[model samples]
Target: MRITWIALLCLSLVGCGSEGGKTGAAAEAQPEQTFSWKLVTTWPKNFPGLGLAPEHFAENVARMSNGRLKIKVFGAGQLVPAFEVFDAVSQGTAEMGHGAAYYWQGKIPASAFFTAVPFGLNAQEMNAWLHYGGGLELWRELYEPFNLVPYAGGNTGVQMAGWFNREINSMADIKGLKMRIPGLGGEVFTRAGGMSVQRSGGEIYTSMQTGEIDAAEWVGPYNDLAFGFHQIAKYYYYPGWQEPGPTLELIINKQALESLPDDLQAIVESAARAANQNMLDEYTARNNAALIELVETHGVQVKKLPDDVLAELQRISTMVVDEMAAENPLAKRITDSMRVFAKQSKAYHGISEEAYYKARGQE
Candidate 1:
């Protein structure tokens, strides 16, 4: 009887072990599930750098995930209007949105810091602030209330001031000028004596061509050239002071994000991070070639804003930023942090980019 009992006990132990092994193996073999998501952007689909970046981001995500995760890309006005993307995502009408954060300032004043600040850090330094300077955490906290999870989607490096039909020799030139500008730049311009009209890419060309807008600023050379702003305007200006480093954002719904599996969630965040880097590189590479084409092949005339105008604008920009900060607590924190980061970056850059350029001039 004792020998029989021992045999039964051993058999039961083996059975338990086998069952546990099977459970482990099944977990390992869990077929990676497939999912489809929708991404909407502020720019028209495939519309140069701004629009094309989202398409590329989606392709990269799908390819990298081995088709386990798929995203359909929609351009501005296709799924929603350009400015409506934030609300669309927050309300769960769409899973994701791609656009500049400043466009959402009406909802969250701190949104401007995620995009850019007048006379602020350029692309490289701004990335450091967002990723390494505790800025991203603050950004997420601010977006949480809106049920949105924001990611750095892309950046247009230092941009051009824009194109003008007439010369802007002094601050007086901007007076009464109807300019197609967007975001915080528009607010600053309004305070500086210009009438700022917020228009989408499709509308800017016609507005300029028909003389409805005397001036307009888009992204730098690559996009400005594609829009054919040169044909309508005689002078193209440089140093987009308003948008030193405009970071495009990927606004994902918080609930939608939470529903994603751990792996899928990681894949989405990683894909956006990769896209942020890729976009800046794309703009840097393409802008060089596009600028050459604009000046040489297209007869586009490039001009630097007069020093007096730039200085005056910068002064007004300081006041505008301060006034906005005073109205919003979150905006105040972000603006203060941004200013600190910018000052540190400028100090370092003064010895590097600034020094290099100065030395190059001597050569």
Candidate 2:
């Protein structure tokens, strides 16, 4: 009886060990956990430049993660209205959002720094400031209270002033003029004696066609061309003063981001950086072609904004941004950082980029 019992016990132990080994192997090979996220945007679905950037970002994340993660994108009015993007992401209605930060200035006045400052950093300088000059830290700090995190997603370089139906010959011309402008630039326009109308890209064409707005400033050549602003307005102006280098943002819900795995978190961040540079590259390459097409094929009159008008607008921009900064201590910190970085960048570019450009343009 003892011998029989010993053999039976050995058999039982072997069976148990085999099962345990199989379970261990199965656990090691378990399917990688997958995550799905939704992203909402302020631009039209897959529209060029601004609209396409987020799509590009989503694609990169998917490819980099190798099916471990996926993101779905909803354009303006698809998942939510354009203006609601910030709120949707903040409240966790969406996992991610793509838009300019200045759009939410009503909620946090200091939000404008992450987007653009009137006469502030240009595309290159803005990137340097955000990624290298400690601007991103301030940006993240400003957004923390709202339960959101921000990333620099895209840039429009130096945009054109805008499309105008009438000539801005002087400050007299600006008086009583209605223009579709937003953020600090809009405030500057309003203070310059013009009525600034807040309207999205979809609304601008109709407003201009119906004579509701005398002028409108969309993005520069690439986006302006895509919107076909040339069809609605006669004069296309250069040097977008309101948004010298507007940085589109990728705002993510802090909770949703934290829920991602460590590797996924790294993937999301790396993809954003790549997508950000991809957009600037696209604009730098495609904008000139679009501008040529507008001027040559569409008979659009491409003109430089008058020097005096630009100067006056700059003066107002300085004052308006300063006052805005002073209104909040946080904004003061944000603007102080921007001012310091801009000064340092300007000092270097004055000798390098600016000098090169001047030499290239000489008679």
**Which stretches in model 1 have alpha-carbon errors above 4 Å?**
1-27
Determine which window of 10 residues in candidate 2 has minimal summed lDDT. Answer: 14-23
lDDT of 1 at 115: 91
The CA-based lDDT of model 1 is what? 0.87
Residue 95's C-alpha lDDT in candidate 1?
90
Question: How much does each candidate deviate from the true structure in C-alpha RMSD?
Answer: 2.5, 3.5
lDDT of 1 by residue, 1-363 (tens): 366976787576745446554445666686877878889988988998789888988898898788988999999999999989999999999999999888887777768778988888889988999999878988998998999999999998999999998888888989999998877888888888999897877789999899899999989998988888878988889889988898999989998888878888898889899989999998999998999998998888889989988888888888888988898787788788888888898999999999999999998
Clash statistics: count for each candidate:
0, 0
TM for candidate 1 is: 0.92
Report every candidate's CA lDDT. Answer: 0.87, 0.90
lDDT of 2 at 318: 91
Model 1: lDDT of residue 293 = 91
Clashing pairs in 2: none
